[model samples]
Target: MKTQKLKFTFLVFIFSFSNLFSQYTEIINSNNPGFSESPYSVGSGVYQFESSFFLKNLSTNTPTSLDNSWGVDLAFRTSFFLERLEFDAALTFQRDRLLGNFTNAYTINSGLSKIMVGAKYLIFESTYKDKSKEIRSWKRRFAFDTKRLIPSIAVFAGVNTDFVSDVYKTNTVSPRIGILLQNELSNYFNVITNFFYDFIGTNFSEYQLTITGTYNFNDRWSWFLENQTIFQQNQTNTSFAGGLAFLFNKDLQINTSARFLREAGNNGSYITLGLSYRINRHVDSYKLLDENGNEIIDTPINRYNNKRKGFFNRIFSIFKKKNKGNKTRNRGKRKRNN
Candidate 1:
C-alpha cells in the first residue's frame, strides 16, 4: 500500500511540474506571415528567424498615380534571461517605381525602408483548467473554459533608426511602443491583438492596431485572417489579409499571404511568401522532490528562505505526517500486546 501511494504521488508531482513550466513547448513558436505579433515569446535559449518577400501595387488619385513596389522583410528573434522575455530586430528594404499623373513619366526609388530593434516581455499569463482530466461526464470534458476570456498580455518597446535610404529616411531616431494580447480560445483556435504607437515625437507619427485570428486544421496545417489599421494625422489606412501556413517540421514553417489595402487616396494590394525557422537549445531546470511529492530544498538555508510551496505538496505533506503517526501508534500497540 505504501509503495503504491508513493508511486501515485510521484506521478502527480511530475504532472504538476510540467504544467508549471507551460511557457516552453517542444515546437517552435513563430510570429510571421502576418502583421500582428503573438504575446508569447520563443522559449528561452531559442533563436528564430522569419522573413517574407512581397510585391505590391498601389493606385492613387493624386500626383503619383500608380506605384509598383517589391520588398523583403526580415526579422530575428531570441530569448535569454527569462522564458517570458524576447528580443528582436526587423529590417525592410524596398524598390518603388512611381508614375506621374500629368507627365506619365516613371520615377524610380530604392533603399532600406525600415529598421528597428525591440524587446517583448510578457506581463500577465492566464492558465485554464485541464478538461481532459475529467472522466465522469463528456459534457464537462468538452465545455468551454471561461478563463479563456482573459488574455495573456505582453509589452513591447523599440527604437527606430534613421539609417535608411534617402527616399524613406526620417533623419530623426524615434521610439515605438505597443501592447500585445493573445487569447487561446481552444486547442485549434487562437486570437492575437496588437496596439502600437510608432515614430514617437516625429512628423510621421502613427497609431496602428492589428487583430489576427488563426485556426489549426491539424498538426501541420493552419490558416490565419488579419486586419490592420493605421491612424495618422491626415488620413487612415486599413488592410485585410489572409494566409495559410504549413509546418514542415517542428522547427520550420512556410507560408503565403495576400493583403488588400485601402487608404485615403490610394488602393493597394500585396502578396507575400514567407519562411520561419528556429534553432532550439532550450534546457529545463532541475528540481528535487521528496518521496511524498513535495519539492525539497537541498540546503537548510535554502529551505528556510523559500516559504511558498505548491498546493499539492502541502496536501500530500499532511497525508505523509498522518501516515507516520499511524505507524507510531501501531508500533506502540504491538509493544503493549507483548
Candidate 2:
C-alpha cells in the first residue's frame, strides 16, 4: 500500500520538475551537455575544456525514503592536425549514498566511475557560403550560426575503462562507435542526432540513440532539449534533459541543466552545472621580416635567398653591369665615326 503511494509521489515529483530540467552551454560538442553530439569539430590545433558537476536523486518505489548520488565529470578535447579530426578524454568521479528507514545513512559507494578516450573524424560537411550570402551579417557572425547545410556527418569511436580500485581497473575494455548528424533547421534552431553501439565485452551489444535540439537566443545565450534511449537485451532506459547556456564570451560558456531518468526500477532526476572554454590556435603567416618590421616575403625560402646575396657585393655587381653597357655603346659610336 505504501509502495503505491511512493510511486504516485515520484510521478508527481518528475512532472513538477519538468520545466526546470531543461538547460547547458552549447560549447561542448559531446554528450555532457546533452545526449546528442555535434558533427562539427573544434577546428585544427584548437583545444577545448569542459567541467561539469551533476547531482542526481533517485526515488524508488520503496516505503521509506529516496536514494541519492552525485558525480563530477571533466572532459577535454583537441584537434591535432586538421579540423576534421579531434581527440577527446574524460574522467568521472561518483558517490552514492543510500539510507534505510530506522537505519543510519552511510556511503554505499564512492570511486572513479569511468575514464574515456576517443577520437572523432568529420567525414562530410556541406558548403554553405552560397546559402549564407543573403542572411549573413555581423549579428549572425557573432551568434555562431555557422551551420551550413543538411546532414553534416561525422564518425566517432571511443573506449571506456571502469575503475575498480586504486591499483586495479576493469580487465575488459568497452569500445563504442557512433555516427553524428547535424543540421541547421532555421536561423536560430539546430538539431543533432547520434546513433551509437557499444560493445560491452559480452555476447550482446548495447545500442543508443540521442537527439538534441537547440535554439539560439542571441550571441551569448542558448537553450537545448535532449532525449536519449538506451537498449539492451533485457531492459531499456530512456532519459530527457533540458538546459540553457550562457556564453560569457566566444571562448568561455556556462550552462545549467536538469535531466530525468525514466525506468521501471530506478527513477531519478539530475541537476547539473557545466562550463567550457576554447583555446584558439596560433597561426603565423609571415615568413620574412626586414629591419623596420616590414614583411619582405611570404615564403620561408626568403631567408635562404637573402643569405646568398652580400650587401656591398650586390651593389658592386649592379654598377659593373652599367659600366659595361656604356663601354659597348662608346665602341660602337667610335667605329661609326672612323
Candidate 3:
C-alpha cells in the first residue's frame, strides 16, 4: 500500500510540474531590417550578419555636377549571454562617378568609404503590459517579452573612420552617440525611433532623428516605412524610405528598399538590396523535444537550464528510490525468517 501511494504521488507531481511550466512564454529576439535599427538587442549567444548593396544618383548645382555611386555595407554583431550588451562592426565600400562639367568629370573612385565599430547596451526594458508581469518570476532573465506595450530603450556609441581621406585630402575620425527606443503596438505592428549626435572632426556637429514602423501581414511577409532628418549648423536634409521584408524562416530574412534624399545643394535617391541572418541561435521552444525525436514535458526550472533533467527523469528517480527502499525491507524480513 505504501509503494502504491508513493507511485501515485510521483505521477501527481509530474503532472502538476508540467502544467506550471507550460504557461511560460519564450521571447524571440527582434531582428528589424531597414535603414533604421531597433532599440532591442540581438540577444545573448547570438551572432548576426547584415549586408546591403545600394546604388544612388545625385545631381548638384553651382558647377552643375551629377554623381552616380554604388556601394556595399556589411555589418556583424554579437551579444553576451543574459546581458543586454551587444558589439558590432561595420564597413562601407563605394564606387563613385562624377560628370556634368565638374572640375574632374567622369572620374571613378572605388574603395572603402567608411569603417565603424560600436557597442550597444539596453538600459531598461519594461514588462509586458499584459499577463507577462504576473509570470515574470517564472521566466529566465535573458528572454524579452514582445507583448509589452511599454518600449525597450537602449544607448549606443561608435567611432567612424574615413577611409578615403586621400580623395578629399582630409583625415578625420567621427564619433557618434545615439539612443534607440522600440515598442510593439501589437502582434501586427511595431515601431522604433532613434536620436543621434555625430561630432564630425573639429569643425562641425550633426544631429539626426529617425523613426521607423513595421507592419506584419502574416508570418512570412512584413513591410516597413521610415523617415530620417539631419540637422547641421547651416543645413538640413530629410530622407524617406520604404521596404518589404521576407522571412524565409526565423533565422534568415531578405529585403529590398528605396530611399529619396532631399537636400538643399543636392537631391538624390538610392535603392538597397539586403539580407540579415542569425547563426546558431535556437528558440526556447526547442526545449520541448528530447533526444530521440520524442516530445518531453519541460518544467519551469529546467526550461532554461537544459543540463537539468525533465519530468521523465524525475519520475524514474522517484521509482528507483522506492524500489531500493523496498529491497532493503525485503532483505530484513528474510533475515528475520532465518
Q: Which one wins on lDDT?
A: 1
- Model 3, stretches more than 4 Å misplaced? 1-33, 64-66, 100-104, 131-149, 162-165, 168-170, 281-338
- Which of 1 and 2 is the better model by lDDT? 1
Q: Candidate 2: misplaced stretches above 4 Å?
A: 1-32, 61-66, 98-107, 129-132, 135-149, 162-169, 203-205, 284-338
Model 1, 1-338: lDDT tens per residue? 88987787677778767866666778877787899999888877788999999999887746674478998999999988887898999999999888876776888888999999999999999789888889999999999999999999999999999888898887899999999999999989999999999999998799999999999999999999999999999999999999999999999999999999887878899899999999988887645566666776677756654553656776677766443343433444445554
| lDDT for each residue of candidate 3 in 97-151, tens digit (9 for 90 to 100) | 8664646557677788777888888887654534444555655433555456578
- Candidate 1, residue 49: how far the Cα is off, in Å: 0.3
lDDT of 2 by residue, 1-338 (tens): 87876676555555434322111123434344775767776655567888889998887645344478788888887776664777888888887776655666443667786788888988886544334554656665445435455677899999877654443255677898899998876768888899999866755578999999999898777899999898988878789999998878767888889999975568889899988877766342222333333444655566665775767776777766443343433444445555
Top TM-score prediction, candidate number: 1
Better of 1 and 2 by TM-score: 1
Clashing pairs in 3: none
Q: Please give the ranking of all candidate structures by TM-score, highest first, separated by commas.
A: 1, 3, 2
TM-score of each: 0.84, 0.67, 0.67
For model 1, give the 10-residue run with minimal summed lDDT.
Answer: 323-332
